[model samples]
Target: MKNSLKLLLSSALLLTLAACQGQDVATLNLEGGDNIVGGSKVSSWSDLSKHVLSILTGPGERIQICTAVLIRDNIALTAAHCVYQKNKIRIAYGVDLYEQGNEIPVDKVVIHELYGGPGSGRNDLALIRIAGNLPRKYKPVALPSVADTPYQGQELITVGYGRTGWMKGAENDGRLRQVAVNVDSTDMNKIWIGRSNGKGICQGDSGGPTFLKKNGEYYPIGIASYILMMSDDPAKKCLEGGVLMNVVSYLPWIHQNLPSLN
Candidate 1:
């Protein structure tokens, strides 16, 4: 609903891997089949249910357009691009947006100091503080430890309230979704994830979470950033792979800003 065409086109130019040489591969077009290309609808509540949040932009007739992850009862983490242009934002939790959920107003949005926007994808992280504490159902997710290491071929799960398919365009629909992707590579600030068995990130998934499991618990390792279109066909939508901002690399910055967490 926020007119993804502009964002998609702008991101297309930023996909070149050469620009990101030292950090990671330059951006490439996304390509794939179905499932998010292959993701499935989340059926019921789970540990991930409370930590994943839907971000709604605009006033009055707000719509779920992006995703965020809760790191505290009143704090959430998302991509810098998701909150950079707005003064106020709203986030929702629960199974369905229209049916059952809580829409919390965000009072403060803090974007990373180094974030350079669509072109560079540098420091593409943000933190949002809700005006008040949420109910117990909205639980905080753990951040990855600084010592945690990411390797190629590692399997990771990504969760969001984004589009199920690209042909129909972006839709909130109020349902949460999950997809599994494999880490293709990693750098100091970002991780590249490729669709595993057809599952990948879509248009509305920006600012979502890419989780890694440890000790039977899931920790957020990356923040959904951008997707690459795999095909040259202008008609194709949300085709192939995507990128996530590595959370572990920014722990010190996060701790500095969100002092309460310390």
Candidate 2:
């Protein structure tokens, strides 16, 4: 994640706002929640990293503002906030410098029209179509057929290249890390905790995937969205922890809008 983005410690104290400031992801207080949870890490493009893509704003932006996951053969899933007007956006996949397969570009991008919210729902998600078929080297992750599972206190894996440090200007890349977090039951819209182990998504991790560990496989669960309400007093400027969005809530929308890629 970039240094400019803001992550909230708790969702309860979030100040109701329309748009997120430069780096502030003002949603609701997310700290000490019992519903959301996470873990896991990936440094580069592997079987795991292949599912992870850098959602770059432009060809020469020099930095990834967020991360995303490939849900279908050529469809990449992410947060709608990552999409901006006239921005040169694309997904970088199969990024193995030493191997034959490397980066794959996105063919197009589509975000929900009501992502910013119509002032009622906290809708925030997007889909990206790559320019070509997904090579065998890169396969997409499976989405949950039902949202009946992944209850609060459940375990999950949070993977991304977000900044490792808490202060501004701190950054992480290539290398991925995983941390265990608990779920915030009340806030069905978020994934809670993760900071106790000194790890959580920030800045560049905006669109990264939060996977649920079940049986012996990982299922896509949440997409890192906005963070509202700081851990400490904002007037005192204290940074405590942060929160992430739950993508599972949009399962019905995802099924209805996703274009069949076969």
Candidate 3:
């Protein structure tokens, strides 16, 4: 979500906001949390990185940054909170925010009906239909089908434009970065990954993509939601792993909205 951690941490004192900013994932029961350890800078929209996107939301100087994944030429998937209750939402297709790329206007936004609000929600997923075609260099990632049972120790690849460090002021340069994490547990709506292993997420990453690799290909299986706090202070967000919205479980709803998905 654009406002992610830095901006939204101002909401409540020690609690209230559990998810990322803007989407403010409504404090989940994430079992484990992690850091963005061993992440490498992405220089191009090729390979698996092609599907990742940066979201510029809000208005004027307060425009917040977030991330998303393209599933079709015009359809992109993201966290509902990231785009919800916001304005002038634009989708940027590029590796770095400052670099040259296509920033397309969003023609349609499909936020989950179950989404609670900016400060809370159950299902955090959302979809964006751009007014123009995606850039030539950009490509969609493979999507998953029915929801799969999330087991402990399962590995996944996560990509987003969020803070690299967990601290409140940690640098979130709006660059495309990625990290690998393992599933620590699960519940009805989210898959918990990491827990103080020093690898996870912070602000500006909400609604990003978490991929499951199979047969030499990557498939988006999860959506980046929020960070579980390690202490009463929201700054302690990064130390805990993080929560991922299970994409498989939302396929029916997704296909229902973007009927062209299937």
Candidate 4:
């Protein structure tokens, strides 16, 4: 079953544990380079910690995933694939995934009508509605109505509950790390090149927010969709780099379908 799951989504898992493992903070080379990520870079993990969340099935279930910020207080955003398999999806606030903490039940799920597979090249966004008011500690991140396009040397930050380590034994440890990678280009939804060669969004980091740091403010620009591990083919729909759908490009569809996501 696990093998089948990976084949379907191309998600990499650390063998010793179910947690994800692809990239880390130390790997990011934030200095200016060939691929510009954003206009600025993230200041600290403290500023973006609230945006990180654990998407789980129960207090201690194996079927857990990671997600990221969308709105200020009411809505939680993630990949359509995360909520599709199970309806009883819950968002756990704070860094740890094991504790019940301030976990909140998701009352409703709104997926894009045109959403296909994770590789379908369509809208892959989903908005999860909590049953009641959100906890004070779990503040939301703001989604930009519009975003500035990426340049050659601009830096960007990606935060999520992905694998803390790049090896098998440390999967699912549930520590959120931020990596600063320069965006190579935004040709389509497929190929996203980064200056930091070893940094990227892994399996568990799916649906996490990719921030465009500008003038000390982080804007939700894209949702982490897929990561490219071994290619440089520009003609392919997916490449050997990370793939993130532009949230700013789909703003109209997102707001019209899931107002809470706005």
Residue 58 displacement in candidate 3 (angstroms):
1.7
Candidate number with the higher TM-score (1 or 4) = 1
**Predicted candidate 4 versus true structure: per-residue lDDT over 11-101, tens digit per residue:** 2232212321233322221100011122222232477766666565422223445575747476777666666654657776655443334
Clashes of each: 18, 41, 19, 13
Best by lDDT: 1
lDDT of 1 by residue, 1-262 (tens): 2234224322422332223224333453121101244666766567788788877665432322568888877888988877765664677666554455566777788888888875457788889888776777778888889777678998888887655655534443556788788999999998988754557776667788889988878899988887765565423435567888899898888888897433
Which candidate has the top score in TM-score? Answer: 3
For model 2, residues 189-226, the per-residue Cα lDDT tens digits are 65553455444554445667778866756677877664
Query: Any runs in candidate 2 off by more than 4 Å, and if so which?
Result: 1-46, 59-63, 94-102, 117-121, 133-135, 186-188, 229-239, 260-262
lDDT of 3 by residue, 118-236 (tens): 54547888888878877677777767865445567998888877566755555555568777788988776788878556666555677888888888777888887777654655555
Q: How close is candidate 3 to the true structure, as a TM-score?
A: 0.81
TM-score of each: 0.80, 0.71, 0.81, 0.72
Give the lDDT ranking, best first. 1, 3, 4, 2
Task: Quote model 2's TM-score.
Answer: 0.71
* Model 4 vs. true fold: TM: 0.72
Model 3 misplaced regions, further than 4 Å: 1-38, 147-149, 233-235, 260-262
Weakest 10 consecutive residues, lDDT, candidate 1? Answer: 26-35
